[model samples]
Target chain A: MGLEIINTLILLLLVVAALVALRVKDLITASVVFGVYSFLMCLLWAEMGAVDVAFTEATVGAGISTVVLVATIFNLKRKSSD
Target chain B: MKNTSLIPVVLVGFLLFYASTDFPEWGDPQSPASSSPVSSHFIAKTGVDTEVPNMVTAVLADYRGFDTMLETVVVFIAGMAVLAILRNFSRKKPVKRGHEVSVEPDLIVTNTVRLVVPVIQIFSFYVLAHGHVSPGGGFQGGVLMGASFILIALSWDLERALTRFPINRCMVVAALGILLYAGIGVLSMALGGEFLDYAELEKVLPVSREMARYHAMLGVEIGVGFTVTAIMFALYANLSSRGRLEGGL
Candidate 1:
């Protein structure tokens, strides 16, 4: 029950972080925050016993997607105003 | 950037919440996944037929071999796409204007990353090699291996790094990997029992069927690993090196 409560809290925090990411003006920081959101989602998946999907999400989402997005940032100009 | 869509967002969230209600309880041993016909078959026959310790690998290499082959093709296509994009645009001269300085330090903190990279690479190989008896497999290990190169790229100059590992060679290796996988399948057909049937190869190779299957699976896994690792690094290189040349402006 304690673990369940903690998981719920963590999920709530992730939702808040995602909202912040979406509302943020800086594209790069927002992308990084989105990556963090993906990682938190992976944890939620694992907690739900979807181990295989969680594994894919953690690797592809946190690892590959982050690298790709960071790389993409090099090609674009920084600081987009909302 | 600040378009209001609160109703749609709330509706989507509610729909997702509703869908979660139908899902099985977390970690319930008697959940449908554990009790399903497919899982039951896997649990029962995996040891009897494959004799391999890892059930996930048995399913991936033996039962779902066709899907694995197509996945290798997808990796090959990604490598080709990266090469095409990089060759056309990446090699073009950067438009020079004035003095631009890097915010990040050019030199790494120490040799720690360099020292750890080989260890990580070795672990990835171990994961790929022991996949038959372990949880890791071609796809997982392949990405881990690819990450080593990305690390190197991060800590070093892109121009010098490209010289050490050219994108064109990576593309060739990726293509070769897919072809090698198909070649093995064709070789199996030539030996007798349809394409990709390892049992037939066992009969021709004078080895036990189980051992032959193990060897064949290893071959395909290596192919997948190489193709995936190469393609992933290629994409990383192309994406990271845009607008930068051999020497900084």
Candidate 2:
């Protein structure tokens, strides 16, 4: 089904996003990637008919969390210590 | 070290996949969750009891109100904790960093944001008010509202944003939100019903029991929105300024 393909693609991208968020040395890049991961998860939730959860994911997870993370990053070293 | 860690990660990933196989298929009617008496009861009676089209909102703001109240409290406490830890009250000059430079906000960005902020705030209100019939509710709406303020901070500066929404006012608004939620519960209780029994609100409002619940849910959501909006901005303001509450990203 078309829905299943979109879901599968999103899931794959989620994995890539997650891996990139971890692998990236730049904290700002990682935070932005995490936002992408959250948005993909939101799409997955919406696809599965959890609209309320998806909304929360889009707003809190993807939106506010990204801004907050970027704010924190600016106040600290931009690069990962490890 | 990273390569060695990947072994455990891959193993855990496989273990999760193996564990998930035993779970019921998605949306299976015969699944334990789908067939549970509680879910069935909610699905069957939520409309009758609350007159709310959105069952998720009904369950969150009415059925599980106590839990949501505490969740709001948790958000408030987290903001307070961050403030306590990071807020700088000592009278000392901030050391100028290499990156710290006075710069004016970009004209194009400010103009674009000026046009966008009002729409975002109004949309957030729509999301909050229309939650009973739609997918959104307090948390999503409140986050959107807070983000509007953060956008102002981003486009302009923290001082300009704070001038609109002062830090002390933020705390007052956050606590008042909890008070409003609990006050409604107490009022319903005072009207000869158990705590948070919104049906008792029928005594005061010229509406039926179900309608009373519907309106009460909206009130509860407003309380949640207030706390979440204020605390969210407060969190960003304090965190970005390292509690000095002046400069921002």
**After superposing the true interface residues, what Cα RMSD does each candidate give?**
5.5, 3.9
Residue pairs in candidate 2 whose N, alpha carbon or C atoms collide under 3 angstroms: none
Error of 2 at B79 (Å): 0.7
In model 1, pairs of residues that clash are none
**Per-residue CA lDDT of candidate 1, range B8-124, in tens?**
888999999999999987667689998999999999988777677778788888778878999889878876775566544545566543333443545453276688789878988
In angstroms, the error of model 1 at B127 is: 1.7
Local accuracy of candidate 2 as per-residue lDDT tens digits, B45-103: 99999999999999999999999999999989988999999998899987655565656
Model 2 scores a TM of 0.95
Q: After superposition, how far is residue B157 of candidate 2 from its true place, in Å?
A: 0.5
> Which run of 10 residues does model 2 chain B get worst, by summed lDDT?
B94-103
Give candidate 2 regions above 4 Å deviation: A78-82, B1-14
C-alpha lDDT of all candidate models, in order:
0.75, 0.92
